[model samples]
Target: MASTEAPEVLRYAAFTGDPAGGNPAGVVLDATGLDASRMLALAAEVGYSETAFITGRDEARRRFSVRYFSPLAEVAFCGHATLATSVALAERIGTGALLFDTPAGEIGVDTVTGPDGKVRATLTSVPTRSRPAEAIEVDATLAALRWAAADLDPDLPPHVSFAGNDHLVLAAASRARLADLAYDFDALTAVMRTHGWTTVHLVWRESEGSYHARDPFPVGGVVEDPATGAAAAAFGGYLRTLGLVTAPRTVAVRQGEDMGRPSDLTVEVDPYETRVRVTGQAVPIP
Candidate 1:
């Protein structure tokens, strides 16, 4: 059978209202006939961190198959791409609830039009989990980042956390530390690949519910991610696991300022559930 070409891709930035401040995503509104190779090629051509392909939908249009691709490979799930895709769908189909069947698991996204008539996307991830980081792994990661163990935030120990994809959570003692992100990309990528980490979540906790964050995604062939939904979800799990925040609390993550693309992520933890809810707005890139 002949393969059909994919639909034209729409580009959008998620988590920030400004076009210059959020993570860029490629949204293929309809990917009925596109294959994995085509999607991956398209993603590489777009050169964004991730691109989302929307496959066929169920009878109610509430359930759909979604695939995510990075510049170099396909990811199990992508938070920023999910948000961008939801906002794009909301602009056309109107906002409500949508379910995505990703490689990792089912994800729920709710879209609501704000007072400004802008659609905001909220994604509820799979059940979250975390484990202590091995001493050797931590040391390797630090060496790749060119930082000493003392530079880490004592309150937030290193750990591997997952929402949809896995990430290593490393908290900085100060915002300055997070801002100065100079690391050996290849070295970091090797370490991340060894541990099956998607990205390194570098964070600085501002308060009980607010944080400043940066994500190094050398493994994805990107130096850094302007907006990271997966890392935010993982961080939420980390916060809950460490008893840093009570359940049913909302945490805000401020990211991308250092890279000139400022983005915001709102994470909500349910009292009785392990899933993390991440909310943000996405806008079309001009």
Candidate 2:
């Protein structure tokens, strides 16, 4: 029998004002009693891309310990969940700074009213890093996606990037290449598991500080993610690592359009700093 007492879950879609757009996330403001199994079950029931549970809190510092769950597993960190959680907290406690002690590291976020009069949240990730993807791994990944090396963008090289979680970043030469996203789910899942990757951040850069993105989350039992915070952070790091963009700059990411759930992300890179900041607005999903 299922437990009668379950924590109430708040639903929010991050990165979009419209409830029907963005990535849906389950936000549990207080999860003191929820265990791993319970959280996972709740996530499965919610059927969102991911769910965030706030376990511990410090009123003085406005800090909390947050855990993230997908239907099948726990992730070290999640961008969408963090954004959702921050907005949820802001609604209750009012807009301010919130610190999160995530599995990956301590992250700081700020919630403030936007010019449009809506509450928006921004999270500054831990130090970001990136490395060249191994040739063998790249080959395997391409095989799983049924993509050829020639299809890759010469300007944007492939790399394994990390801000909170690791992501394989690949830039498509054209928007068409990015739009046609057919891949072997099982094969990609196997490769992602072996590589300890959370998602594959496929992108087509439109211009400096603007790009379209798609995330393949086979490892999490999802074909594609409408919006991915972690990947955005990592991709910001990738830009910095490659000197693709000047620091102290903000970049815009448009994702989930192909899936019909559009999302927007703002990534800020500080000069001489490794941490990347991602900001977005989340609204309740009726």
Clashing pairs in 1: none
**C-alpha positional error of residue 69 in candidate 2 after TM-score superposition, expressed in Å:** 0.2
Cα lDDT tens digits, model 1, 1-286, are: 4256547999999998888789999999788788888888889999999999987787376788999999999999999999999999889888999999999899999999999988999999999998889999999999999988988999899999999899999999988888888999999999999989999999998898899999999888899999999889988888888887665899999999999999999999765678999999999999
Pairs in steric clash, model 2: none
**TM-score, predicted candidate 1 vs. hidden true structure:** 0.97
What TM-score does each of the candidates earn?
0.97, 0.97
Question: Over the stretch 106-156, how does candidate 2's per-residue lDDT look in tens digits?
Answer: 999999998987789999998999998999889999999999999999899
lDDT for every model?
0.91, 0.93
Q: Candidate 1 — which residues are off by over 4 angstroms? A: 2-6
